[model samples]
Each structure stands twice: as C-alpha cells, then as structure tokens.
Target: MLWRPFGINETIPTTIGALTVLVAGIVPWMDVLNIFDIIRGASLTILSTIMMSIVLESIVFFGGLL
Candidate 1:
C-alpha cells in the first residue's frame, strides 16, 4: 500500500539519504549563511557521542571472542 523507493520496507536509511542531500546542497553557502555556526557545537557533540558508542561496542564484541 505504501511506496518503497529503496526496494525495502525500512525508511530510516532513505530519510537519512534525503537529509544528507539537503545538507550537501546547503554546505556551499555555509560561510554566507551563519545557521551552521549556531548548531556546530551540538552537531560535533552528537558525532563524538556516536563515535564513542561504536568504539565501545566493538571493544566489547571483540573482548567476548577472546
């Protein structure tokens, strides 16, 4: 009943892709537009948190095998 562009039922990846395109389009004008500066700190914090989570998960996964 619903349209699936990516050929799968999950929509999260599609949504992220769309957002990435939108951001890419706006990146060229980031210097002229100060909006990115406003969120830079928050974005960096979120990215670091995600990176740390992945590192911890990998350590635990490998530790279990050893």
Candidate 2:
C-alpha cells in the first residue's frame, strides 16, 4: 500500500491539543508586541523581534548554524 499520513485515522481532540499548545506558546510575545495596542497604543516591535528570533532558531535547528 502507498504511504499515508497519520494513517487517515486522526481525531479532533488531538489536533486541538496540538494547536492550543502552539498558540499558547506564541501569544505571550505577541502580547508584548503591542499589536494589542492598535486600540491601546501597543506597537509591533516585540512581534517583529519574536518572528526574527524564530527564523534564526529555525535555521539553527536545521543545522544551518553548523
């Protein structure tokens, strides 16, 4: 048989758990960015910093740093 992802038997709760963790991890820094300030005066500075850091970490994670 051909290969298949998750064996076509995935469940909704598992998917939700994964997505929840992903967002929780990112939200704090997003809060710092002040994008929340569009209505309150916060800015994008922190969000930008977080994105750049993720990119750099991704590179290193892929062994580009070596």
Candidate 3:
C-alpha cells in the first residue's frame, strides 16, 4: 500500500496493519525460541490485535483517507 500506487502514504493505517501482522508472526517465533518471555509474547500479540482492529476502524471512519 505504501509504494504500490506511487504516492500512497506509508504512515497511514495500512502500515500499522501490515506491521502488526508481521509482529504477530515474529513475536510467536521469538517466544517459542525463548528469545521473548511468555508475557512479552502475549502482550505483543494483544497489541498487534488491537492495531489490526484500529485499521478496520480507520477504514470505516475515514473512508479512503488517502
């Protein structure tokens, strides 16, 4: 979404959405390998989930704010 259309704002909600999805995967892996504690992983998961929710809200509320 950032560069695909050439001028899409990289700082927009889509960025947060994509970043959270990536974190969802990376955090779990970090936890499984003992790089992150259970608490850290769980918190990160929650944060990512919340960010995803916010993306939906932004889409509905702003309606293609780009």
Candidate 4:
C-alpha cells in the first residue's frame, strides 16, 4: 500500500492481484541485512564509543591520566 507501483495503485498484496503478493511479513527484512545492517553497524560503533568513554571516566575517577 505504501508504494503505488502499478496501474495507479491498483495492485494490492493479495492472491487476486496481478503483482506479487505476500500477506503478512516483515517490512524491512533485517534477515537480508540491507540498510538495517548498516544502521546496526553504526549503532554498534556508537555503543563501543560509549563503552570507551565509560572506561576512561572510570580510569580518571581512579586517578589515571588517560
């Protein structure tokens, strides 16, 4: 329904439709690892940076320069 990739939004995701149809499924198919995969990688990198910050803060709290 989001995309009007047919004769002016005529085809629906149903068996009766001319186009390919899938009743109920995942939208962004994370299993295939597309854009979501890149987002996940970026998130992981951010989390690693947060961990590094926490470690540095802890070290400073314990009287360390780094």
Candidate 5:
C-alpha cells in the first residue's frame, strides 16, 4: 500500500500556478492600476499555501507516530 499525504496532488499544481502568477505580477509590463495589490495578494497566497502544506505534513507525521 502506498501512503500519500492528504491533498498532495492538488497542492503541487496549486503552488505551481500561484508561483506563475506571482512571477507575472512581479513583471511590470503595463502601467496598470493596483499592481502592488496583485503582487501582495499573490505573495500572500503563496505563503499561505506553503504554510498550510507544512502544517498538514507535520500533522500527518506526528499522527503516524502515535
């Protein structure tokens, strides 16, 4: 039997997509309004996703020890 963390499959793709968005936000190609807001939101999304993954993995690891 193979053991996989919950949402592992979805997490990778989501993180990748978020990173792509973040990069796009960083590039200043157009003089659009609220660009900073876009960058901030994307950064927050990436950070939260990473933090959530860490927490979930830790929980799974500790739970397995019990």
Candidate 6:
C-alpha cells in the first residue's frame, strides 16, 4: 500500500527512513531541552536591548541632540 510516482516501480523508502531517524532523535531530548532554557532568554534579552536603544534614539532624534 505505497503510493509512488508514476514510472517508478520501486517505492521510495529513503525519505521515510530519514524522517523517522530525525523524529526519533529529537523526541528523546525534548524534555531535557527547551527554548526558555537557552534561546528564549537570550532572544528576549537581545530584543529588549534593541527596543530600548530604539526608544533612546527616537528621543535624541526628536530632541535634536543627535
């Protein structure tokens, strides 16, 4: 019960195999790792800095300080 492209007699199994391995690898580590553990914190810190800088720049720009 495999739906394959026309003219190809053998079903393509490589794609299925690769996806299976990828999911299996990630499923085990999901609990031990999370975005807030590293990435989310860093990203939020960076975003806050950028936003503050923009606000400061706007004040300076409007005030003719720079």
- Candidate 3, 1-66: lDDT as tens digits: 424565666677677885787687854654555744647878899999899889988779646557
Candidate 3 Cα outliers beyond 4 Å, as residue runs: 1-36, 61-66
- Residues 1-66, candidate 2, lDDT per residue (tens digit)? 365576754566578875787677955666555654564433366677788889988778646633
Q: RMSD (Cα, Å) of candidate 2?
A: 11.9
Instruction: List where candidate 6 sits over 4 angstroms from the true fold.
Output: 1-33, 61-66
Model 6, residue 23: what's the lDDT?
Answer: 82
Per-residue C-alpha lDDT of model 5 across residues 2-42, encoded as one tens digit per residue? 64567367568678986787678864445334676569888
Which residue window of length 10 is worst by lDDT in model 3? 29-38
* Model 1 misplacement above 4 A: 1-32, 61-66
Candidate 4 structure quality by residue, lDDT tens digits, 1-66: 566765564434453442222224433345445766669989999999999989988878656655
State candidate 6's TM-score: 0.40
Task: Assess every candidate by TM-score.
Answer: 0.47, 0.29, 0.35, 0.41, 0.37, 0.40
**Range of the 10 consecutive residues with the lowest summed lDDT in candidate 1:** 26-35
Which regions of candidate 5 are displaced past 4 Å?
Answer: 1-35, 61-66
Sort all candidates by lDDT, best to worst: 1, 5, 3, 6, 2, 4
Q: In model 1, how large is the Cα lDDT of residue 23?
A: 79
Model 3, global lDDT: 0.71
Query: After aligning candidate 5 to the native by TM-score, how far in Å is the CA of 40 from where it should be?
Result: 0.4
Error of 2 at 8 (Å): 31
Model 1's alpha-carbon lDDT is 0.76
Per-model lDDT: 0.76, 0.65, 0.71, 0.62, 0.72, 0.70
The sequence of per-residue lDDT tens digits that candidate 6 reaches over residues 1-66 is 456667554535676765676688854555446634768778999999999989987888546633
Clashing pairs in 6: none
Give the 10-residue window scoring lowest on summed lDDT in candidate 6.
27-36
Q: Please report the candidate that would top lDDT against the real structure.
A: 1
